[model samples]
Target: MAFTFDGPLLLVGAGKMGGALLEGLIAQGLDAGRVRVQDPAPPADIAALLARHGIAAEASVADLTGPPGVIVVAVKPQVMDAVFPPVARLAGARTLVVSIAAGRTLKSFEAHLPAGAAVVRAMPNTPAAIGQGMTVCVPNAHATPAQRQLCEALMSAVGEVAWVEDEASMDAVTAVSGSGPAYVFLLTEALEKAALAAGLDAALARRLARSTVSGAGALLAESALDAAVLRHNVTSPGGTTAAALAVLMADGRFERLLKEAVLAGEGRSRELAK
Candidate 1:
């Protein structure tokens, strides 16, 4: 993908998400001199990663310099107030401020920056840790189309990118993909336990459970067929798969349970934003 933003990029944190972005950018051929990281006590592995990639990681925000073209805030929600001010001072007036802090709104950044700063709020999933993440970017009214494009380019280097006009939809995004990995992990665990209970050896159960889920995901990703159609393709009439489906779909229990779980996550996202 052709990208226009070429100046310095600053990241405020070096946690999982921040580290992932740095790695992705390096993979995308971003120059080491163009990226600067600000994180105290950076993880040793990530520190080595940045060092190996030739990107600079500073111990203090004061140590970072230059007129940033893209400044990403990847810190936790709880530390936003503490991190934003110094970053605001360092960012250029025309810099595009991108954030992946869950539940942190554009307005929150606006409060700490000069009026009319270009802010883009994003919610990215953990799969970003491995460059298969899905991210949603919502730009504030102050942001221009060019800035939005820059945001898309930066995020797409890691994985997929989508734009949302309504900020309220972020909570829903968080509820779905942001917390989606845990659901899949739980399913994997449950399948392994059930396989073990059904007289399978531990190693066999784990292999079956992991491979089945991963292969299904790979198939879905490579196909144009809808998930419902794919699922139906696997279920034969009066078969064992059908029997399992009957229990899972019975009385709409699974659907309702999933809905409740997403709602609970959405509520917590709102609470954290406060």
Candidate 2:
């Protein structure tokens, strides 16, 4: 994929999302020498991963030299204020900052950095850990076309990437894809309990529920058809699946419930941005 980004990258965090991006970038041929991690306390596994790759993590960016091609802030929104100031000092005319911290707007970074700091705010779901994530990005006015393209190349290494001109849409992106994994997980959790209630053994129930949810996701990913079409194909008249769908779909109950759930998440995302 003609990976192109001038200079090196300085990653500001080494947690789940950060760690996942690091792994993906390396697998896609980004040189280890071109990447540096700054995390005071990364998870044990991630620390080991850095060590194995011979990429040493700095406890702070205090001594790090830069004019890095990119600075990716994959930190928690709660600490961004404290953690980001130091990072902004490293920015040069060529640096592009891409942030995956939820609820942080491009304006938020602009407020802290010097004028003309090219900033992009991106939202990626948990699936990114395995490179199946859906990421949506919004770049500030300062970001150049080349920087935008570079952002796409950097992020697509971890998953599919999309762009939006309206940063307003990011709150919805946070609601739907960003926090949506938990909703799917809750369904699997509920299904496991329901299977047990229906007299299945514990082990079988666990296995069935987990496999069914994952398998259905795999099918959905592979098929070009819409999910509704796939659902209808599985549900025959008078069949068990049809019967269950009837109950869940009655009066559009399930769809309405899911809409409410997503709306709630959207509201919270907005709150965090404030």
Candidate 3:
């Protein structure tokens, strides 16, 4: 079901991520007629669904109305400059600007909008497509509590959300959560490869790898136990699980490797900003 926001929504860039959010909103029971979207080639499913609800779809922002209650910027960061200037012109004084463009900041949006414009920057991962996304948002100084509430309500329609007082932490959030799905996918791939190396058929290995990881994650979600406790629960002394743990714990190898990988992601996020 689509979640309802306080008022109308204007979604820019109806690509994969944007389309997923639109579906989530409808699934949450948000009024589809109150939504407007602009995209060059919106997905067939999205276009049909929006049309069914009386929502308008246009090829360019110029065809959309001005000063939406919530204006979501889902366009790619590389094309943000080309996409937002006209939006800025159309933004009303009270319009809340929410951006999900990785590497772009609130200041960038503020620069394009009217003085004292409310801007919220968010980092959402690919998992949003599956409704398991972890998103982090932060508001510019000009944003009021009411505007923050609106942004939070709008983003929550897609997935869980958190806030960081320090804007610098946004880059770290991008490193950890924004790019986290790829890391998890990589782990699943490695597990499948390892299973194949252990003489399992490729198809069986993939099914086992994906199901095991996904099931364990679901269990963790339903449990009160912390991750460490969960790990200990699976590892009996002198058992196979313990044997695997021994290799993973040896010389702090896996921990160090993951730390390095996250640092690399963080660095790359900053580099993209430049």
lDDT of each: 0.87, 0.91, 0.83
Residue-level lDDT of model 2, residues 205-237, one tens digit each, is: 999999999999999999999999999899898
Cα lDDT tens digits for candidate 1, 25-48: 778877777778888867888889
Location of the lowest summed lDDT over 10 successive residues in candidate 1: 58-67
Candidate 3: RMSD to truth: 2.0
User: How well is each residue in 1-89 modelled by candidate 3, as lDDT tens digits?
Assistant: 43334446889988778877877877777777778788877778867867777776787656544567788889988889988887778
What residue pairs are clashing in model 3? 1-27, 1-28, 1-29, 2-25, 2-26, 2-27, 2-28, 2-29, 3-28
Cα lDDT over the full model 2: 0.91
Better of 1 and 3 by TM-score: 1
TM-score order of candidates, top first: 2, 1, 3
**Residue 56 C-alpha lDDT in model 2:** 85
Report the C-alpha displacement of residue 159, candidate 3, in angstroms: 1.7
Model 3 residue runs over 4 Å out of place are 1-7, 63-66
Which sections of candidate 1 miss by over 4 Å?
A: 63-65
After superposition, the stretches of candidate 2 with alpha carbons farther than 4 Å from their true spots are: none
Which of the two candidates, 1 or 3, achieves a greater lDDT against the reference? Answer: 1
